[model samples]
Target: MKVESAIAQRISRDALISILLYVAPIALMFTTFYLTGYKPWQGSNELPFKAPGFLEDVFRNLSSWGLAAIVLGVGVIEFAVGLYENKWTKNERTLDIVCFVVPKLVVKPFVAYFGLQLMPYLLPAAKNIFEWVPFWWAFLIIAVADDLTQYWYHRIHHQLPWLWRFHRTHHSAPYMGMAMAGRQNIIYTIFFSQTYLTVALTYLGLGYAALFVKVVKSLITTGAHSSIPWDKPFYEIKWLNPIGWVLERLISTPATHYAHHADTADDGIGNYKGNFGNMFFVWDLIFGTGIITRKYPTSFGIKHYQEEEWYAQFLWPVFKSKKEGSELAANGPMVGDAVPETETVTLKQETANVAVA
Candidate 1:
């Protein structure tokens, strides 16, 4: 009993330290900005928010091309490392490539353009409401708001049967890598709430902060979905375990996020029902939807997955799967009806019988 109590107390101390490590950078940044007289709450109507010239310059110089370059560089590394086997089917490859290019080239630009245009007309008087916010504060606000929205968006799609079809394409891949991160449906990309939120923040004069947060968020999410277990070493090295502990709680690490894409929950490492965090794992931890084992799943992808065409996965309702019983097919299960009770019971029975046999 004494040993158990000591172990628990030690874990509590380590957890607190880890959280501090994750939060210290944000605290420092906010303090620095405040010392520099960055006050978001005290600005005149004529020159609301009055962003620092350096910040404006940084935002202006930020290039989407640079992001593309990073993606390509990471892709080269993933390929060179042979992270994927013969798992990249023709449909999978096509879907991933198209999803990757189309969003940047078409969807995001269209959304941002229209969002900027619509915001002024819809809320004309509220134009610079949050403009007076300090850059650091604005960045923190946008980061949390954007990430929380995405967390719910992702969680709902998994919890509710109807929305799963749209998200299924992402989990269809048998392997994990940088390419897999972009594998999403057209509707999913278009309806993504964060894109509009970002545009709104830009209009509110946090464009620079929003841009910086977006870059950091992208890196965290991309790293989470990659096949490489980059965080593995931190967990393995005894001295770095504290860093790993805090990191997995603060953001989506490979171990926690990979569990979400794992093929089956039967394996201890695969947790298909939880770990839905995209950029921030804290949501999952707070919402009782996270599981962390510091281990990798042996298999990835959906259970009983039907091989649907790339078009069906990408276009969805417009291009239903030809596979008769597939969830994305025309005559298949309705939204919210993917897993029937009878089917679940039968599955359990089969498992029980196998165990007995």
Candidate 2:
């Protein structure tokens, strides 16, 4: 009886600490983006947050509501699934908040500040190139370019060892949910947000290509992390195949990204190369990343990782393991001389042939 009471107390304390840590960053973000003059433009020529009619304008506007719906929906669905599936114990969520949320919150503001404020002044020529474009074209171009950059970076995360230790936390969800989607290391977020935002800001007026991808990435990521497996029908729809083939070619698909999260190394499935894609699978298709699984992975998460406490997941660079070969995201550990066999047959791509997604 005493032990049970003590355990409960500890869990409660941990959860409290985690809550404060997670809430701080998001609250700050809401304050920052909203307080800044980043409000929506009223003109028709302006992009992002268009109101269908005047009355629809009431209820704090559809755009803000839409964003809230997406975020809350993802969180509710993820935590709900986690609760039901027992895939993530309460402790796991602790690690997730720390590992995924805190770092991003801290990192994003500074990145946004620099990208929006400081960087532009340094590159006036880039600024001119940026300002010279119409919104729609800029939107389209930025959308394509950002995804193109992400494709390579995501692929490298899978291929690299030390980096995978952190990035792989994202894929560590045993089952999917909206929250699971955001579960990643601060280092991964920094690398991604920094690079993507840098490229993104270079083309700021690209309308919502910048915002669209962020929103789309949010939706798709939540959907991808969802245990519901929307990919089944997406793959089964005969008509969707052609359209999907086009979309998946240009962006990541649930099937492809899910395989990246598959539990077993050789899950007898699609590409487990740990290469994640979103918004554009074309990068993979163009860069030899296209995998024709058509099936979501049966098993998900690292093949040989131990479940670390949640704090390690977020505060990895800090308060996490750095021991060589530790089972918990152990990097640089010798996995014996046996190299795992890969069933994937790599086909070389010819640069001469251009495939548009």
**Highest TM-score against the true fold, candidate:** 1
Tens digits of per-residue lDDT, candidate 1, 1-357, equal: 685476456546644654554475557756876799665467622222544665444344323232233334444554454335356877787877787767755677666666677778888877657666666666776787678778778877876666888888888888888777878889988898866776776666666667668778888998898888999998999999999999999999999989988987787888887898899999777767789999999888876578788899899989998997777888877533134455678999999999999
- Residue-pair clashes per candidate: 2, 15
The parts of candidate 1 lying over 4 Å away from their true place are 1-39, 43-86, 334-357
Which pairs, if any, clash in model 1? Answer: 40-132, 162-336
The weakest ten consecutive residues by lDDT in model 2 span: 337-346
For each of the candidates, the C-alpha root-mean-square deviation to the true structure, in angstroms, is: 8.8, 17.0
State which candidate has the highest lDDT: 1
Give each model's whole-structure lDDT.
Answer: 0.74, 0.53
Clashes of 1: 2
User: Each prediction's TM-score against the native?
Assistant: 0.76, 0.64
